[model samples]
Target: MKKLLLFVCTLCWLLPPAQAQTGTYKGIGTIVFEAGAPLSLIKGTSESANGLINLETGKFSFDVPITSFQFLNSLMQERFNDKYMKSSRYHKATFVGRIIDKGPVSAKGEAKVTAAGILTIHGVARKRTIEGTLVQKGNNWQLITAFPVELSDHHIQAPRLSSGYGASTMNVSLRMPLSPTDPDPQQIVAVKKFGFR
Candidate 1:
C-alpha cells in the first residue's frame, strides 16, 4: 500500500503542468497582399484572449474571438469588418497544438516546432499544420507562424476585388506571445505587452 501510494504521488507530480495560457500573443500581425502590388496591412491586438500553455509539456492552445481583431486605421478596420473576415458569422478562431520540442525560449533565440492542430473560422473547423518560431523573453512565449491559408478550404470566398489581386491563398501570420492564464500561482507576468504595446 505504501509503495502504491508513493507511486501515485510521483506520477501526479511527473504529469504535465496544468495550462497557463494567458500570454502576450496579441500584436500587429502582418497581412501580405502578394496577389497584386504586394500591399501590406497590420491588425491591432492586445494581451487579451483565451490561451492555455502547459509549461511542463510545452503544449499550448490559443483562441481569439473575431470581434477582438481590430485595425487602428479607421477606414481599414471598417473595410476588414465589412468585407474579408465577416466577423458576425465567425465569432472566434482557435488553434490547439503542441510544441515538438520542450522549449523555455529566450530572447533572440529561435526554435522550430511543428504546431499541428485545428483552426476555426466562421464556425468551420479545419486542420492546421504549420511550423513556427518560438521566441521567449523571460517567461513570456512568443510564437509566430507564417503559412498559406486557402479560403476555399473552408468554403470561404475572398471579397470581390475591384483590383485584380486574386491570389489563391492568403499569407497569414500570427504573433502569439503568452504569459500565464490569470490569477493563479502558475500565473507568470508577461514582459512586453505585444498587442497594446
Candidate 2:
C-alpha cells in the first residue's frame, strides 16, 4: 500500500497541468464604428475580428485587420485606408488586457464587466478601461460594448471634406461570440506575428 501510494503521488506530480478554460472569437465576430461626417454619419464595419479570452486568468486579446473594414462608398473606403487609417502601414489594430471583475459567468443573466488594457490603433497604443456586458450563451460567451474613440487620441486626423469637417470622435461597438475551445494554431501564429501575447 505504501509503494502504491508513492507511485500515485509521483504520477500526479509528473502529469501536465490542466488547460485553462479559454474562449476564441473568430469569423463571426463583428466590429462597427460610426463617426459624424460633414453631411451624414460615416459608418464602417468589419467581420474579421479575432481574439481569445482565458476565463481562469481573465486575460484577453483581440485583433482587427484595418483593411477589412468596409464602407458604403468605394471612394470613402479608399480615402479611409490610404489617408486616414494608413492601413498599408499599420495593417491591424489590437487590444490586450485583463477583465477586472473575474468570476464565473452565469448563463441566466448578464454581468457588467470592465476590461483594462492597451488599445493600439494607427500605430499608437493607449491605455483604456472599457466597460461592457458579458453573458453566457449555451457553451459560449457573448461580449457587447460601445465606446467612443477620439481621433486625436491616436494621432488620427479627422477628414477635412469639401462639404465640412468630420467628427473628431467616433463611436465604436463590438459584438463577439466566443466559443469555449483552444484557439487555432494559425490564429496563434498570426497574433504572435503582430507582437501580441
Error of 2 at 9 (Å): 12
User: What CA root-mean-square deviation does each model show from the true structure?
Assistant: 8.4, 7.3
Q: Candidate 2 versus the native: TM-score?
A: 0.77
The residue ranges of model 2 lying beyond 4 angstroms of the native Cα positions read 1-28, 37-39, 102-107, 161-163, 183-197
> lDDT per residue, candidate 1, 1-197, as tens digits?
99999998777556443222333233323222223232543344534456665544546677776666555667756655566667777766777776554333334665566777787765678987778776756545576767877778766666444465454565666666555444343544332322211
lDDT of each: 0.56, 0.76
Q: Where does the lowest 10-residue lDDT sum fall in candidate 2?
A: 188-197
| lDDT winner | 2
Query: Candidate 2 lDDT, tens digit per residue, 126-159?
Result: 9999998877665466888899999998999897
lDDT of 1 at 56: 40
Predicted model with the maximum TM-score: 2
